[model samples]
Target: MRQIPLALLAPPTHRFDNFLPGANAEALAYLRGLSPGDPPVLLWGPTGSGKTHLLQALAEHWQAGGQRVAWYDADTPLPWELPAHESLLLLDDCQRFDAGQQHAAFALFVASAGQGYNIVATADVPAVDLDLREDLRTRLGWGPSFALEPLGEAEMRAVLRREADRRGLLLGDEVLGYLLTRFERNLKGLMTLLDRLDRFALASKRALTLPLLKAMLADEKIDSDPNL
Candidate 1:
């Protein structure tokens, strides 16, 4: 059997179509309809709520239309001056920004004000809970803010089923139920584990079953803990 290249096993691209918007329909619509000169948007949600995915999707949409866009993450050093002509700017993990970074962000915001540029940011908590300068916090809330709700169990199962279908794998309800009950419920982690299972199934020419899953977990545990 031919071995699959690691590069070819990259995760699926984040897009608007695949995002399961539960109670965030309004937020999704607002993001999709954004135009030049629209006020900035702040999306607040807990971990695994798809905030980063939504931001990436929005960036993809803008860039696909030939618009200049810049994406900044929490770990990236904040630029003193953002590109003045960029049409869209995305700042992720805003809650992690330090005071100096917040100052730089504020400067960038002011520079883009009234220039038909749009900014979208995400935070782990609501704007009121952010520990930033009062003025900066206030500006972050200048536009409409949306709280992304976590997907429920049914929605997660649906997501898993879709992912399995996309990969041309058959995931039974029993397996999915077991996974949900025994493993992490976050889509990111679940999908990662699913990818591993898919690879194992293909390589071993074995159907995905509870026994296979158990064996895989046992192997993983031994690999991680040699003393086991």
Candidate 2:
């Protein structure tokens, strides 16, 4: 059997309550306020931003109300028929779509419009700047679009502290600063790294500090190398 890479594993579930809106409160409100007959919505942001989180939250919101949702990504096949009073069509990672995905996404958009279903899409860039087909690009730029901003350092600290509390792990400001300054600034990746570091510390019966973190990373580097 082969082991799956961390990057390939499915991310944890996302919900509205778990999201830290920060400067994206308006965007959050917009998604939550969408109606069945509303025009399509596009959310763009850099990687590790909260675009995926919000999209999943919206899907969760609709699903909780018993509405049907059709979710499509670069790899997944779209549903042929939409069923239910309110249907939500979500297209994720639009910027990375192949030709087939772009075509299918455009068709989904048309069908969603015809059926008065709500459509929401996410991309790394705004539709006007997308590299997809011209028509599809135009269609994507048609509806309300919002740009998500990365969390500020202060906001990130709050999140780290909150999560640390939940995990019963104590992280000092110095250690947290070390992580924030050295890590890739995405909350998902940071959280995963934190989880790994916590486990390493527990197994070693050592305190979690900058030195401990460095040792854990060094150990992981050696473990991942077949020649080592």
Candidate 3:
């Protein structure tokens, strides 16, 4: 197996909650199987959805229980070299791998599938469209390939409320409703906005209000630049 790049495979700094209502059930079920041992699993979803969150949650769970866990992200090259022995494997954005990485990833997938070592992958499309090698695609589809859909309005609101609570802030329905109407629809994007707003508010000695949100939204320079 080839060595996966460290920067590309790392998970996010923030915590991902697994209790999201709209999160895929089968995906959670696959994660649950990791309790006793690592099981190879794959999750599919679009950007700004919950793919990374779920990955982080799974990693945190295993790590908390004193299990060895590793994560690989899109920035890393594909066909990740599997560990010599058994350990949880999380390869995100499996489809984004280059041709060589894809071949390597397929081979690793085969090995992981055979051993039932905990493995999870995320892709933009289903396995078929990933341009994966034939055998590897079949193996990914063979088990349960969970698709994470865009969170609905209600679910998104709940997520905002919960995250706000976690941050020791008060988020009312009015604020949530305003954000839902004005910001991007995805939970991930909304969370990003919330995090930024929280920091900005604290620094500027302002409250979380519609005026501030509007100011944040209207800042064309920041709005266009996602990293802002």
Q: Tens-digit lDDT track for model 2 on 1-228?
A: 223224333445688888899989999999888888898899999976799899999999999998888888877864334445558888899998888888888877776666778889999999999999998998889999999998988888888787777667799988898778777678877787888877777777778888888888897872322332
User: What tens-digit string does per-residue lDDT give for candidate 3 at 67-160?
Assistant: 7776766676444677776677887887776667667766776776656476678887888777777776776666557788878888888778
User: What's the ranking of the predictions by lDDT, best on top?
Assistant: 1, 2, 3
Model 2: CA > 4 A from native: 1-13, 77-85, 222-228
Clashing pairs in 2: none
lDDT of each: 0.84, 0.82, 0.69
Q: Order of candidates by TM-score, top first? A: 1, 2, 3
| Candidate scoring better on TM-score of 2 and 3 | 2
TM-score of each: 0.88, 0.85, 0.79
Between prediction 2 and prediction 3, the one with superior lDDT is 2
Error of 1 at 104 (Å): 2.6
lDDT of 1 by residue, 145-190 (tens): 9999888999989988999998888898778877888776777778
Candidate 3: C-alpha RMSD after superposition: 7.9
